[model samples]
Target: MAEAFTIRYIQPLWFIWVIIAVYIVFYAVFNHTEINVGAYWFAVITIAYILISAFVNPRDEMYASIIGMPLGILWAMYERKIDSYFEIGFLRKEIVAIVAFVILFIGRLTLSVVGFDNQLFQSVLRNIITIAFIVPLIELLKKVKIQKRFLIWLGTISYEIYIIHPFILYFFEKETTEGKQVGNLEIVLWTIGLTLLLSSVLQIVQDNLVRKVKL
Candidate 1:
């Protein structure tokens, strides 16, 4: 069980760590610098990495996500300024973003249904669509009033949910491989429930450990 869990989780763990480390270093260097060369350098590096990965290991989708790191940094740095501009009342930036997101999402689905199998193009398109969806969605969410304790709890555990849900999915898929026919809805529900439970437990354990260390 330990070996199986390790095998299933190691790559994702490593990938997340690498992303975090890269983002930290990138942010540190550019955050205080007068001349922001981070984006330029990141673009160059990302292009090179993509080209090499495409030629050498075309099967790897990791490079596609890595390319978005610099963009994330850029967005973070300018997000407040962008948000202020979008808040101008008449521009309706959120509505525009939502429309674009829906159009792109539908277009992607239509293309897929029609047998569009260009991985690189699809990956790029998906990234763009995600950014379009998320930016405005986040802006809109900022105005939402959360009165439910469960939703508040879910928000607190969201990161852990993201990290642990893949393992849950993998475990269920493995069970299916061993002859258990788990339906899609069952898998989704199980993944969510298990993720929330595990993350909450882990968070409590971490808090206790921190208190013990401080003591």
Candidate 2:
């Protein structure tokens, strides 16, 4: 049982936990500072992920959870390794997503406790947590047949939705800041509405594009 758990839950990239720990240390120190070193480090890491992904063959590292989830399926299909698809089950998919969300939420709450304005913290926390969890959860959920379809959509045209969401929030924040008092319910409703509308619009656009391109 122990060996099975180890083989299933543990992947080759366990060292990433150490990397993330270091990042969290820097993030804690720099989150509200003028130096913005955390953001710079984030940019560097993003660049590295993009570069590393390009060089690695899609087969060997396919089952790595988080960003590797969807890539694994693609690699499996590419390499005809469908029989070994059980390798991905090692990850308790929702557990990791939940943990990531909790970490981000606590991080933001810590920032608030340290003297950042409540309004600012509330304004940014939801969106930031969503993004932080997206990639972390995607790899696990993507391995499931049903969620694979949804996540592939997210993976494909994600940039458009990501960029557009901030502007959408900016407009909403402007309205609230101008005169409209944003109650808790109002904020909740706005988030639900914005997420649904934007997600639907992006899905439709992606579907149309896929059909046009014969993908």
The residue-by-residue lDDT of candidate 1 on 1-215, one tens digit each, is: 32454654455444444454455555554554432565666666666766676678655455666656666757866889878877787247777778899999999999989999576777777888888888887778777787999888888777557656766777887799899889999988888789889989866764554343211
Stretches off by above 4 angstroms in model 1 are 1-43, 109-117, 175-190, 197-215
1-215 in candidate 2: lDDT tens per residue?
32454733333333334233333443443444333353454445544553454346343222122233223224433443432442465456456567888998898878878887444234435555765565455555546666577667666656445534554566666678799878868776776567657867866765664343211
lDDT of 1: 0.69
lDDT of the candidates, in the order given: 0.69, 0.51
Score every model by TM-score.
0.64, 0.33
CA deviation > 4 Å runs, candidate 2? 1-164
Q: Looking at candidate 2, what is the lDDT of residue 37?
A: 51
- Measured with C-alpha atoms, the lDDT of residue 10 in candidate 2 is 33
